[model samples]
Target: MLDAMLPVILLLILLYVGYTLVYKTDEPKKERKIHEDTQEVKEKHVEKPKKHVAKRKNPVETTAPKKQIQAEHPLLVHVLKGHTSAITACAFSPNGRFIATASTDRTVRLTLRESLKSKNPTFKTINLPYDYATACSFSSDGKTLGVVTADGCKVSLYSKFKTKPECITTFPVEHNVLSLLLNDIGEEWMTTLTIGKDDNTEIKCWNTSGHLLQTVNVNQIQNYHGVQSLDNRFIAVAAYTPEVKIFEIQRAKDGSFSKLNKAMGLQGHTSGVTDIAFDGSDFKPVNHIVTSSKDGSIRVWDINVRYKLQEDPKCIKQFQAPSGYYSTVDITPDGKWIAMTQGSALYFLKVATMQICCEIQNAQDDDITRIQFDATGIEIFVQGTTSRIIKVYHLPIE
Candidate 1:
């Protein structure tokens, strides 16, 4: 009986061991988990293409950065060549139909804007009474022309609309005229003149008839370029010492105007301030002044804050140029763009962001003496000083 009981107990123990091996193990669950993980990876791969398609639908998001990149190659529309010597100054007619260029060759040429390349274009060529015709400007109606010369400190007035200018009158200045600007209406003008080979310069205000209205001594600052505001309410002079002197145009109740007094001084440039421009004001308030310097910097000043801080007028915007020595600067009529010259290159900057819209490298062989934008801001005229080449460029529209 003991042997039989031992055999039965052994058989029961074997059956228990077999049941534990078949049902108590976790291998199937582990295999199912691995298969689920592999399915999740496959689902991820299926969703990736949908995300890529979403990105492809919005190409503008990728292409928007291209707008900020300036044009590497500038489109040159025309090159004008008629001057015998270096072109000293240039001005665009208010109507945008003509351009007046003065040169050291003792000649002032009025070239038709539409036909800059025509050999027999509609133009008026006049010989200056002196060898150096330093600067020239046109009246608002495009009826009168004003020219300043280095010899005898002479300021000559001429009438337009003819094949040749008819001398209206000549005014004598006390010093060599360096810069001249006429008001928008042409009722008044402003000038900066040097004093007898000295570094001393004076700022003068004159009427359209060549009568001196007021004068201020700017000898301390070496002011070389002066411009009147669009409303003729202020005069700004760019100093070689890297400063801008602004004077308010005051009017008395007695119907007489008073002499200019220093209203504000803008100082930021590390080198000489080469050129200055004001807001063109198309029924909008003129509140800013733009300046370029020889130190390769440009600044925009707020006139409202200038009155409060005359010693150091506040600059709202500042930009470092790609190169040094900006010779000239001009703002568009709508205050949208700034056309500036750095060496022989011409640059157009968007006014809002100060980002370069486009640049024309090697625009000429020599330095650019002047740059002016048309009333519509669709065209720009650039003149190389010693190169004696005038270039016309069509501004890119957004």
Candidate 2:
């Protein structure tokens, strides 16, 4: 009886053990499957918000390019292209009807100002015989165009420049011309020439017939940069020195250039001056002059004082450049704005407030060589050392 009881109890215990093993193993698997499904649902919910957020950003990304276009529209007006090489110099006609550009391509192009926007703009190309043109200027009457060549150091005058351009005269220069200017009467011109191998400079006055009237030796001021006043009465020279000298173009009763008298010296800049510009208004004599220097300062000088009385010219205001040396500067014809270049950037400052009104970075492909305003002050012409294009920008400020 005891053995039979033992066998039954053992069978019951075996059955209970089999039930526990099978049920407990399947319960955890079901729990794990449910947890995995919950996690997958949570992941999908998280991705849905991410997709919604991305869709919400689509409009903002689409509008970004429009903002860039609006910012660029007001600054750039026209890009005059034709030269194959770097542009050396550019000048606007006195009447603002034409623009003359000299380039390393050994050609001078006179383009109609109004035709710049048209495809295949109307232009007159004057092929130079020598190397390249270094400087250019227009007579006050806007009837003649003067260009200086580098190889033979010659000055060529062009008459009927607007239509059928003709080289009227080509005269050999004594030295390399750094700057050239034609008098208001168009009968005479002046040039700043580099003398010898010493980097010294001199100013030479000449008649349109190829005769040198007088030579003013400015050897003391090495590396001379000069600009003529609108009235053609004075020349402001910057000589890689802190002081800028003003020379008066003394004329005889017959209206011929007699001599250049040193009128006064502007003493303010701590370093060498780089460029100079006059107000260029219709005033009889230019009273205000702007100078830029390596010291990173642009100075406005009041030259209306009595300099013969030993009075120094007063610096009415001075503004600092953003960085690097100021390569060139120009004041608008209306005297409302001053434009300057530092490296590849162009800055426009309001004359009345002395504040920067606009700044365009990387304005040129290379270092900017020159910056000038049109006769009406509505457009500005900019050129670089290596860029073949002449960029004409509209003044955005009033």
Tell me the tens digit of each residue's lDDT in model 1 across 282-356: 344567888998888888887766474534568988778765557888777666778888778888888789899
User: Candidate 1 clash total?
Assistant: 0
Cand. 1 Cα-lDDT: 0.72
Task: Give candidate 1 misplaced runs (Cα > 4 Å).
Answer: 1-74, 117-119, 162-164, 184-198, 208-211, 252-256, 281-284, 305-313, 322-325
Which residue segments of model 2 deviate by more than 4 Å?
1-73, 186-198, 282-285
User: lDDT of each prediction vs. the true structure?
Assistant: 0.72, 0.80
- Residue range 1-398, candidate 2, lDDT tens digits: 99979999999999999999999999999999999999999987785543334345577667755544324545898888989988988998877889999999889999998888888899999998658998888876677888888888888889885568998888887787788887754444433222221364777777777787777776555754667777776777777678888888777776666777889989889998888888765444577889999999999988888877878889998898666668799888667789999888888889888999888987777888888887677889988988998888888776
Span of ten consecutive residues with least summed lDDT in model 1: 189-198
Q: What is the TM-score of each candidate against the true structure?
A: 0.71, 0.78
RMSD of each: 18.3, 10.4
lDDT over C-alpha atoms for residue 45 of model 2: 77
